[model samples]
Target: MNYSVKNILLATSFQHKISVSIFYPENSSNKSIIISSATGVLQKYYSRFASHFSSLGFTVYTFDYYGIGASNSKSIKHITANLNAWAFDQAAVIKYAKETNPEHKIILITHSIGGQLMGLNAEIKLVDSIITIASQTGYWKYFKGFSRFRMFMFWYVLIPFTTPIFGYFPAKKLGLFENIPKQVAYQWRQWGIHPNYMFGHFKNTELYFSTVSCPVLILSFPRDLFASKASVDWLASKLTHAKVDRRHLIPADLNIKDVQHFGYFKKEYQDSLWKLTETWINENS
Candidate 1:
């Protein structure tokens, strides 16, 4: 179970440098995993999860999207990053993992927007399988009650008013999320208002979803206010060709009080919910 951790810098097609971390076990294995983080969530936050996967005999890779975390430029305001750029960055990371471990199966584990953006990756067909955790489309109508109100304020009011002043979304100051790039904020705002979410904005969205033929496992929590069951179902409905396994986790079934959108990734769930995740990956991947 011994593993080594290393940090490296990768260059995008446009020559922008991105920060990536690799976790490899001492013994080689034929399975490798790429952990794609949620929006405004840093790679560092997922380091524990990466290490856990590496200990399980699978080489694990985690990276920060451009204009976020360690990958951001010296002046974030000057950086122009959109959803396409984020997908390209993820694709570049996948390409690196495949080339580095040619014999290993490349499995993708994505969270939130990471799953939504998979269609944007030109190299997605190269992946063996995908596992989406709390992933869903962000259409405002899919949400109800307090969650809907919160989404409205976040997308319509906060993002619009702050980006003009800070030249970027001041997520950290507002305690919403990590600071986000202006373009990312704008694109998210657009997607949130549309009934189809990102599908409405991305050209050839259907084609992108159709290209993915590998099996997909989607795990969602009943208590997740952000990614409701309806939202997650909408995402699953789009991947018509893929053999999709969608499961809803009830905290009571797991002997836990509650599990939210970000709770599953926390260290406290390492033994309970995390073990369930490992079991699914072992069976599917």
Candidate 2:
């Protein structure tokens, strides 16, 4: 099957324009998928994954959150946004997908923080199912050993010290994936410091998590230090009404070297790890 990609700008209710790319399959299915990116990761990073789904007849939508990637209309320092703000952007994307393809069942594929932000969207009902990849609470205690110590330094030392001087988090400068808005960096730090992560920092947000009743497929890799099994469980436990399916991907069992937090979306895993996502979506849909 053939597929075509079109890049367009989507407007959020907050007056920010998000950069979105829609992949349309030549043979369209009755389903449409929205790929929500992890924090500081660009939408382009998921192009291979989206294209694969598009080739399989699922119309896929991938977008960059405000203040990141093509959506960055101004300097990072001037772009003020936090997790909740990004949630509104995600909600808008969901609304767009539903409105544009009324006949299609909506599927949400979230990576890392993308899954947590889904809880903040009031338009949760728009989604028919969800696939969370390494999405977990940011509470530092969820990790153990060196990973736990790393989280402490990330929250207390690196983020706090760098964000102020640069007016934003220069993740790329520090050899991280991408740069981040100052507020988003600060918000992440605050959540990491809290025992309950985002919910502990913002008490009312917990109600939103409970409202997601759609079937959810949670995928966590054993080697992903950032999203340990315990961390993933913390987030899953909050989905009080959702039918949650948890799967731990052990690289050794799959005859692979590694599939850490970000490796799941890498092109190399298209036949291995990605198959799990495709199978889950088909089963749930």
lDDT, residue 79, model 2: 93
Q: Model 2, range 1-285, lDDT digits (tens) per residue?
A: 499999999999878899999999999988999999998999999999999989999999999999999999999999988877899889999999999988999999999999999878888798999999999988888999888988888999999998999999999998877899999999988989999788876666544788888899998988687899999999999899999998887898998878888998888888888787888888997
- The candidate that wins on lDDT is 2
Residue pairs with clashing backbones, model 1: none
Worst 10 residues of 2 by lDDT: 200-209
Q: Candidate 2, which segments miss by more than 4 Å at Cα?
A: 204-206
Clashes counted in candidate 1 amount to 0
Residue-wise C-alpha lDDT for candidate 1, range 82-166, written one tens digit per residue? 8788988889999999999888888998999998888788878879889898889888788899888888888889999999999
lDDT of 1: 0.86
Winning candidate number (TM-score): 2
TM-score of each: 0.96, 0.97
